[model samples]
Target: MTNNQRTEAVYIHIPFCTNKCFYCDFNSYVLKDQPVMDYLRALDHEMELTVKAHPPGAIKSIFVGGGTPTVLKPDEMEYFLHSVKRHFPVWSDDIEFSMEANPGTTDLEKLKVMREGGVNRISFGVQAFQNSLLSGIGRIHDTDDVYRSLDNARAAGFDNMSIDLMFGLPNQTLEMLAESVDKALELRLPHYSIYSLKVEENTLFHTMYQKNQLPLPDEEDELNMYLLLMERMKAAGYKQYEISNFAKPGYESRHNMTYWRNEDYYGLGAGAHGYINRQRHVNIKGVNPYNEAARTGLPRLESFEVSREEAMEDFLMVGLRVLDGISRTRFEQQFDASLDEVFKRPLSKMVSAGLLETTEDGYRLSSKGILFGNEVFAEFIGTLSAN
Candidate 1:
């Protein structure tokens, strides 16, 4: 409860993938000819240095994300997982250790290593069920690979599982999205994350969009697709915990909730960003540079202490992503100021515009607000001037 309390969550990033997806702008590289084991060792070294600097409490959640964490070989996976366990020795009894995997990369042996190494949750990157759509997005696996991977994961004793799906894809139809959804629901998995495609810079899709080559769904079609999916998910008994994530009861992603709840967590690996002790740090991005820097000390690209005002803004921006919204008491507890007093103007404007509604303990996005969430979040930015 003190200012110096350690964070209870850890995020380890593995920036290697079998192949780069056309739409992905994540900090990951193709696995071919990369220094995979060396990077893992450097990751281990980074963890040791980090723990020494900021000793952790019992970890509640640990998430391993990346281009494709499953791309690691069985021995490599064991070494990386062992390093994690060794560095963060203390763990809660119900700790949620999750890893991101690509459908084609994970096999039975690899899944067994992950399961035996204490990874209880496996989130597969099965972006679409249709083969053509998958290829259009530069995804390596087909629909059959998805089913096989799920079977292997279940055989590996991972009951807590999730899959990532996408809509608004280039050349994608609403009916295609519906088919993907129906297939996803057929599995009856514990969690499902369906996201709309975003054409971020430096990606293949971005170039296609620039040249007007990307056949994307128009605004009206995309909106209808969103509404349809929301209705389908609701009817299927999934809770839309966050704007882009849904889950069965008691199966929500605790590790991601740590980020949405705006709590501190350690970020390891190249290009990983971590916020701890009121400061945020981003590691060096290149593989060689990160490994070299780790030998000397913390491989930090940038580290800055977060100001109180910045923290409050971040709390509102990220915390509001959750459907439950921000708690007034918790805000006051965190900043020692009334949330209403600090953000009265924007809150009033948004509430009046029917974008935000008052909750018993806090404020949450109205139904319309969820649709235009970016607009609502924009109102909070730069409202409070630094004193």
Candidate 2:
């Protein structure tokens, strides 16, 4: 592959959790009785096959995500990290290797193992600061666990850290969210990802909504919670780099930026999704199935090519999610066509409606548009022809 086409980002999925969260819909299973070692071996096989097939560039970012990456024992973590280095050994000097951890899961020993194995950044799932709220949402960690986990990470020589907070949960009030934000800021972490609760199908929240048992905050309350967070984060000197993410200067999540910028990345392990050379594939989801499949070849459930028109739509949709918006230069470079010339109608319409504003070389969401970003993004999807 050419320099521009070689994948530089990787996403590895660790599909075992001590327990599933009530609101989670990710492809993760309970840790008990699962073939953890077998799964790791299968992941190693997948990495070997992936590099042989695609031949990665010097990887710039690698993100290890759910069910909870920290649930792995020290030995397991070491083996997994070794396998990663063996396959994609070449790394960018400033590579960001991040692993998602659940609070209360990472002790000093395990964290030391992680840091020694090359993980530099840690993102803890500290959903809420209140113990009551934490239990209500099925989180296994309390506020104390959050503090202890951060301390452990720091003691193990990690300075780049982030914590996640959630808003718009069941029984979550504006005051509650405000309190959570205050506690999260008190940690003085470099980054924060604050998101609203979404009741997706197959989740406990979804079932409760069907039975009218979920006492979620009203729409107006949820909007207030979002506004409060944006104002608080800004006042605290963190940039709202993305709608949901806040960072201190250079601490923005580079791995996630690869996705927002619509760049190619390798997705390894069970149930992971990868995009390479305009083609996307999702691996087999089940643990045993993935292990069995990887014994022979890539454990892909499905893979397909992405058309140019569809790719353009995706560029606008995800790129606009970033506060920087879409760059005409990048759009042209990727598709060899003028951004304005192709999407003139929607661009003109959104700009005229005060939802989008022109930048020096691109268009971004206006302050007003940021509140209704989903509506603005909707105007681009399915609007292009395959030709």
Candidate 3:
């Protein structure tokens, strides 16, 4: 019933931060001696120009994620949020507005500002509970700061909050992972996103990893961490809707579901990707280029088309990540080709290998395949009908 072309979700990327984390390679910069207000102005310009191309119909969810959205001063944040509200048309209902915050930077006053500015959900980057691990990961906020930040968020009347916790850090043990889970359960938020540490390119962690300075957990231990998290999350009455995300019923992230379900969404800000009107495009990464593009009333699109064959592959790949999988009726409607006709080989192989299973409504990844998803997905790659 939802209109994917006239998307109901939008993502705005804030690319400024106070400090970069050791493992972060996102397009965020240290806000030192930079024209912060000017960047906001450029972002505002981008929003206005970009929405003109798409039908800004009733947005159900808006997620402002970035280098650290809370790093903006109260007035700066006010301007930014207001800019978003002004440009994006919304449906007449309670909209889910979620923003990512860094713990050390967000305080009582700033959180209150966000709440008043129509932010209903807040996801804090409280990566770990131990101060030692926090420092090892190059996070400025310690355990105390995280506690204080959560308290501040609560006081600001933000109930639907989520905290991010990570496992598999350098030298992280099973005990430490348990402690993090226990600490998370104590706060008792409606949702939790638990991720394993990944050494990304151009990050300090990657350099340290190459030099053998970052002693990550062995493969078996890492697998143990995943197993432990799954068991604990289920025990805590949270559903493992996605590989790294757990949520209490009805508190699942609507914004993220837009991505995993392969629905259409508008991705604004530098280096953002969007899929609209059966075409996919990525915005320019350079701040200056994006600004100039916006000024010229043109989108800074690097690529413009996504093949129909590729779209079907994307549907399978992303839909398999969800617990409910894709709707067969919807697939038939979109492609005008039966799901079986389109992916007969891959589906048969997956089901035969016990990696995917056909349900009454559609197909879903099997439990074993959920644990080893990559191998299962790879079987579908080569055989896709080329557009």
Candidate 4:
């Protein structure tokens, strides 16, 4: 088979967590029973096979995401980093190497090891500031640990730092959300990813929601919180580049932008997803399954060829999630079809309904559209031939 001739991004998933958060649906397990060394070996074997076949280089970004990446010891971090450096073959200057950490699990030594190991960006998951809300969501860290971790990161010479915060939790209110944003802005980090709580099925939050025991803010309250956050973040001079992420100028996450821009990224680790050269595939889900497969070959993949029509819809859907909206030029360039020709029907309907507006080179969701984003996205689904 011919190799795909496309520049790609890399995502390395570390699936070991100190403990599971009630709201998390990610493929992470409690570390007690996990085979850490064996997992690493499996991951290394996968890397060897991938690099030998594809020889990935000119990499734009590498995001080491989690089940809490900081759960790995500093030395363990070194082993992984070294593997990445050897296999990916990145230039020293342009690459963005980002790692996600839970606030309580990081320390100065760990941060130092990571920074020196070539991790230029650090994103901490500091979900909420209030201890009451933190415990309510089953987060392992308190507010103090958040600040402490930040201090440790700064001391380790990480200038480009981002913190992930969440609002609209169980029993959370607009006022509380405002305070969370207020607290976050005070830190003056380069980037902040503030997301609303999403309770997915099979999680503890979902179970509570079914029993009517989940103390969630009502719909109106959630909308109020969302609007308030936009105002505050705008006033604070952070650009809402995406629905849930805000960053200072030039500090936007290049790694994540690859996803929002609907570009290819190699997703490594158990339960990771990838869209490489227009084919979408998922890695095996469980840790042991992934490990066993990688030592042999990647297993349990559900792979599909992305048809040209499906690609256009996908580009519109994921790219629209970026606050800047979808690029008509880019859609045409990628799929060899004009955006208008492909999405004329939904585009017209959405525009008439005041959901999307035409920009110079593309279209962006209007105020009403963002509020009802899912509804807007659904219009572009099914088939573009209806246009």
Q: For each of the candidates, give the backbone clash count.
A: 0, 0, 1, 1
- lDDT (tens digit, per residue) of candidate 4 on 240-283: 99888899999999998998888888888888887777778888
Sorted on lDDT, best first, the list reads: 2, 1, 4, 3
The superposed Cα distance between candidate 3 and the true structure at residue 120, in angstroms, equals: 0.4
Between the candidate structures 2 and 3, which one is better when assessed by lDDT?
2
Cα misplacement distance, residue 289 of candidate 2 (Å): 0.6
Cα shift from native, residue 23, model 4 (Å): 0.7
Error of 4 at 334 (Å): 0.4
Two-way TM-score contest, 2 vs 3, winner: 2
- The residue-by-residue lDDT of candidate 1 on 1-387, one tens digit each, is 246788899999999998999999999999899999999999999999999999999999999999789999999999999999999999999999999998988899999999999999999999888999999999989999999999999998999999999999988899999999999999999899999999999999999999999999999999999998999999999999999999998898999898887789999999999999778999999999999999889999999998888888888999889998999998887889999999998999999999999999999999999999999999888777454
| Candidate 3 lDDT, 222-248, residue by residue in tens | 989989989999999999888788999
User: What are the TM-scores, per candidate, against the unseen true structure?
Assistant: 0.99, 0.98, 0.95, 0.97
Best by lDDT: 2
Q: How close is candidate 1 to the true structure, as a TM-score?
A: 0.99
Error of 3 at 316 (Å): 0.9
Evaluation by lDDT, superior candidate among 3 and 4? 4
Which sections of candidate 4 miss by over 4 Å? 1-4, 385-387
TM value for model 4: 0.97
| Per-residue C-alpha lDDT of model 2 across residues 1-387, encoded as one tens digit per residue | 124577999999999998888899999999999999999999999999999999989999999998999999999999999999999999999999999999999999999999999999999999888888889989999888889999999999999999999998888888888999998999899999999899999998899999999999999998889999999999999999998999999999999999998899999999999999889899999999999999999999999988889989999999999998899999998889999999999999999999999999999999889899999999998889444
**Considering TM-score, where higher is better, how would the candidates rank from best to worst?**
1, 2, 4, 3
